[model samples]
Target chain A: MKRIILALAASSILTAGAASAETLKVCAEGAYPPFSKTNEAGDLEGFDIDIANAICDEIGVTCELQATEWDGIIPALLEKKCDAIIASMSITEERKKAIDFSEKYYNTPARFVARSDADFTIDEDGLADMVVGVQRGSVHQDFMEKTFPEVELQLYGTQDEVYLDLQSGRLDAAIQDSIAADDGFLKTDAGDGFAFIGGNQNDPAIHGEGAGIGVRKEDVFLKYALSAAIAALRENGTYKEINDKYFEFDIY
Target chain B: MRFELALQHWEVFASGVWMTLHLTALCLLIGGCIAIPVAFAMLRGGVSGWLATGYVYLFRGTPLLVQLYLVYYGLSQFDFIRETWFWRPPAYLRSACIEDLMGWKVCAADFIPSLRSAWWCALITFSLNSGAYVGEILRGALKNTPKGELEAATALGLTDKQVRRRIHIPSAFRRALPQYGNEVIFMMHGSAIMSVITLQDILGVGRWLRAKYYVPYEGIVASAILYLVITYLLVFAFQLIERRYLRHLNIKAPGAERGWFGRSAV
Candidate 1:
């Protein structure tokens, strides 16, 4: 009876997948720039957006990038509001327990930033115990809340929120991935008031590994398919070609 | 993601719920008191009177959240409020000023900070919004002051103030009891938005939890359940208060079987 039940559930899921073959729902915050952001036309444009499209095309599926709030991104996927999340989400042990992740596509070390004028340092009591901002759903928030309890933690819904608060006086400094801080935040004049402080204290805690595609734990097939495509993209020189457009060095 | 983590973190959810209830109660007590005088002012001033018109136009015109932000962020803009006031005060009171001035410091300092200067921001916004609706309720009840009842007090040789105090106020309140119950419910519902600031009330707790665990469904559902329960209890309290106070108005009141079991008078 249990075997039959398991088989029945498998068949039902497979049937659902076949029923929606043309469309694949993927989630992205679209708030992190160079990775993803809404353009003037409100269209999703960035490295992740292009990668999501390429993966869907490789897998012979039409992709729809759903702009979900960062905080709710994982749960939104678990609830099947979308089939997968292509947001710049990281693969971590804690996250692995709940969901499966595709192969690493792009990697960046976590770094910290503060006002250009502010004297900042990282050690036993790293964050000057001042207001520190981080994008809420990412590993950075978890790392900060755990490692530096003294620092006043301010969470923003998006990268834009973090950058805005960094520019304004809401936060003393922000710790995030170096590439995002440099290409995304420090690249702008508003972010110009800021400079990279140092590497993350939780550098050991956060995977600091490249980002991966997020699919439900049950979607083993999708995970492997995506992983295979990422390997192909890397070997075909397409990955390096795209990486040069966004970064000075390989993110992986 | 384990049931054990959720169980371990239950306090976060529980305290969040408790704080939300705490915030609602405080806002209602503080906000309800302020609304009464404001409503009275609106009522006594003729409809076009300056105080009455401003009370209605200003509070009623602005969104509750916007009003809250303005109160929280706008107050500390004065040098008198933060730096100057801090220096002017005796050293002993700097602690008090520091707490009050923190929210203002952020918004004043930030490009777009949440208005969270002081409790006064929430207090003022809650009072203004609740007062407008409460004023409307008071106005309706005052208008319902029976014409014959007013004359009877006059025939008894009572002064205008005495008549207003004794006969008209009492009877009008009786007539207004049902609407007033509705107003209290509305105020309670509106207090949830106060969590946007440092007021780590239930909603804020839920937000903190969701951010931490990424378990939006569980924490949010828990908070929703609490809001629902509190809303339900509030509704029951209103019905009970209405029955006790306005029972006499049953002389002209609808039958007890009327629309009294409302689940969402809010």
Candidate 2:
């Protein structure tokens, strides 16, 4: 009986694995608004989610979005919790060592957001002894840690918490993607007093090529498929539509 | 198992261990101190006792994670707490306060704790939570003190204050020591939650490593081993303490020899 049950289970697992090929499970950080966020109706929405759907459409696969925490998004993919990660994960050299990435889906520079009334230059010396918040394990964290070591870095689990501390005055400034800070934060009522502090901080060595779809390093075919789908979306005007829905300026 | 990955980041793990140790130690010390007065107040039975009961109920009833979040994030939402309650001391005075304090940067913060800081928030939350548990343990121990001992003290013309100070409290502490040891271990384990608030405790380092490297279980497994070693040490220390302090309570064989250091050679 046990042998039969085990055989049945194995068959079921094999069938599920076969079915998964047609349904691309994509992991996204739902807390990062404008990029990805869960709406009041409990549906995941935003640019990343839309982009993931468009990519899946281009690839002729069903898109299944899985909301995951920012910290464990990559691990979730590596662990097979999802087949791919469509989160706004910057394609850093450090990350490339762990996972494979598609071609650039969208590229945006990191920026610092501070209170509109705050007086400080966006420089290493100017940020001396100031408390700056950034999402933990993010390219922005790497940038701040490497560039402005004088600044006291407070890492939060989510970008929303960074904004929370920033608004509460616990943080003097926060570093994040420019579009995310603008649309998700600065444009909101909660960010009435905050404004972008500096110009685009596009340090490619640290920030990397841009946000890309991450897959397991061994999934070379999936990586190429995703890169091709991204290119198709860009050519077919679906990428522009999604970008327009989220931001006025081109994020691609 | 990616053990090499964890090994390569030994400094991070070491700092994590150091933070966990100090955080647990500080919380235990502060909580133990808070426990004494709370236990006494609960024993006395009045408004203070009522308040103590309420404090214990509130902290013990709710999850530590929620309490921590309330203290760390919830408190920051208030304007008063953000602006004035957590006022930073002047740089000169703060430096003066911690100038000779082993060069630890946090010494000044210890002297004047600010709720705005994650470290202070974590310390406050863990200490209060531990206090409630320890307070209840101490209360039970104090209540169970021998009636004969109290009568004997009274017969010897010992005053109430003297009885409590010299005999009652000391006896209660001795009785509470084993249970208190368990509380210390629990606090050490519970201190892992400090990582959620972004404090680099053992688990924080684990999560950070996992996130940074994308290796699923290596960092967590390393942290688990570290915790296991710390727990083993704690258990061994507690056994030694119990053997020394509670020798009379130990069951002995018919002809057990009294060994050196007060341990029985059974």
Candidate 3:
């Protein structure tokens, strides 16, 4: 009877491991809107949330969405706070040096937005005296520093703060992802007087290929699984469905 | 491992230290100026005294972070605050006689372009917050001043102003120094939050490094050590100041060996 109980307990432990094998914890930046944000009811919602869910559904895995600060999200993933990052993080060489990224899920260009009454242009010379704002720890900030070396750049903790400062005339202009500026701010009432001042900045050197699901560098199996799930979502038109909900154009 | 990365980026850490020191010094200097008059007002005990006390309560009652946000972001929300000249000094500074005596123009715009600026906002918020605490500390120190000294100064035919300047204020300041020293160090720690507004102070640069490298431990540890060193230097400087000003109070034991940190043989 003791031998039988020992065998049963060993089998239960293996079964428990198998049961939890398909469970994936995914993290997203709660502040980035139209991609991922916490709604009035305090639940995660938006395009990234839907895409994360769709990827999990395609792979037949249960997923949990964790909200984290954008600045600390990458560290949180590596620390095992979550298994993946689907918070619209662009695939970059600098980031890939630390962690692995799955296939690009979406591609968006950076744009400069300023108050309508502000007659400033977006060129380096035009923005000489202007104080431009960008979200800290973002590709936009990297691009702003490289492209507009002469212009003063202010880094904000959140994209929403850029909009606030722009409204108050504190920030002369702001550089951000085109869609975030459009759907997250410009499409809203707070961004009424503001308009996109410059054309799309799609310099690959700074913006990178596109947004991807980030995973641990050693998690090759998980990375492939996510890539396959993304492909499945694309083939099954789920990607297009989510894209249409948040954006009018195909971001893929 | 992070320490290696932190050492690799020593320049960033150095600049961070400079910015933290800059913020701390500005807060203390400006806040000290605000504290003196408020301390005197509270001691005077009138309607204006209650007003001064209320100012202290309002600022001290709230968190420094909240006060910072209120000045930096909250005040910018108001149209009047944004458009008006509320950021300029009081109308009294415009007095012709006072301006001539100072021999410098008192134009706020000549110094700062706008009060809504992040640097100004941070400075103002920190100064106001530190002023409240410093004012309270000074009040307590002032009250602890011996009444006999003031009576003696009066008996010596000293005016009320003379008595305050000669006997009361200096003694009160000497008493307040140790506590003020701690407050200064607290301000240094508090200045780390200035990075939240994108000030690029030591803590700001530390967070920037952490964000860039994704090695949070190294940058965090480096900043922690930097702050620790800064606090130690401040404490050492204050000890020297105490030794200089409060030398009469220390009854040195004969043949006692001094330790590395100014501690006696005991």
Q: Which number leads on lDDT?
A: 2
**Candidate 2: tens digits of C-alpha lDDT, residues B4-25:** 9899999999999999999999
Global lDDT of each model? 0.69, 0.84, 0.81
List each model's interface RMSD: 3.7, 1.2, 1.3
Candidate topping TM-score: 2
Cand. 2 Cα-lDDT: 0.84
What lDDT is reached at residue B29 by model 2?
94
> Across residues B122-223, which tens digit of lDDT does each residue of candidate 1 receive?
655776677677666766777766688788779889899888787776676666767777766676667767765445556666666676666756666666
> What overall lDDT, based on C-alpha atoms, would model 3 receive against the true structure?
0.81
Question: Where does the lowest 10-residue lDDT sum fall in candidate 3 chain B?
Answer: B257-266
Highest DockQ against the true fold, candidate? 2
lDDT of 3 by residue, A1-252 (tens): 323433343343235343355667888877778897789999999999999999877766667888887877888887878888999999988798899999999998889998877787778789998899988789988888788888898887778778888887778899888898898888899889888887888888778899999988866666777887788788889999998988888899
lDDT of 1 by residue, A21-106 (tens): 56778898788988989999989988888888877666666788888888788888887888778988888877877788988888
Please rank every candidate by TM-score, starting with the best: 2, 3, 1
True contacts kept of 1: 0.32
Ranking, lDDT, top scorer first: 2, 3, 1
The alpha-carbon lDDT assigned to residue A48 of candidate 1 equals: 88
